[model samples]
Target: MMLEANNNYDKVHFAVLAIGATAKAMHTAPSDIYLRLKKYNLVKELLFDCYDTLHAESIEGVVWNITEALKSRES
Candidate 1:
């Protein structure tokens, strides 16, 4: 690895070389990280659902046509 991990935090004597030769193991288990990351996609699910609902609506298209006509008249 290019950079070493170190907890030797000191204001005056801090140097990059103080990093440990080996990496410290993560405290959070891999399974926990996987589950949390899986939950993070919940927002994506909601966004896709909204996109589908938007495409299903003819009302917005009607409103858009009226607004576009009004905008054309202003020019």
Candidate 2:
């Protein structure tokens, strides 16, 4: 469903609805969705760390490792 908002409060309401719909579509609880979001954020952070660690080293290896780590997260 589409929601129209005239103000911040209305926007917040619509955001909540959108989140709920997303959770339902994924067939997971809202808490589970939150956890996945957290995991993705952590992965992003780890990618940055990997980049820094390999900045003076091997770029190809770092990219491979980062891609593997992200794929592992999917499973």
Candidate 3:
């Protein structure tokens, strides 16, 4: 349905926002951040899966969460 398609679009949009914000906060390229996230499966597991709760959070909060998530995955 149209609603489901819209929801998917919204989630993807939010994911891109988070990636860019996180890249800025980390002083890295968005593409690098995106690749790391994809490597760790965070793009789907963390971004899309948590879209409902994360979309409501502040950009700073989202960036912190993503940074922490990436750090954790590095271990």
Best by TM-score: 3
Residue lDDT tens for model 2, 1-75: 233234434534433443344456557775664455457773335433333454344544544544454467777
lDDT for model 1:
0.30
- Candidate 1 lDDT by residue in tens digits, 9-66: 2211221111110011224443443343235442133223233443344644523432
Give the whole-model CA lDDT for all candidates, comma-separated.
Answer: 0.30, 0.47, 0.96
Ranking the candidates on lDDT from highest down gives 3, 2, 1
Q: Kindly indicate the candidate among 1 and 3 with the higher lDDT.
A: 3
Question: What's the residue-level lDDT of 67 in candidate 3?
Answer: 93
- Residue 68 of model 1 has an lDDT of 43
Top of the candidates by lDDT = 3
Worst 10 residues of 2 by lDDT: 42-51
Q: TM-score of predicted model 2?
A: 0.37
Clashes of each: 0, 0, 0
Provide TM-scores for the models: 0.24, 0.37, 0.97
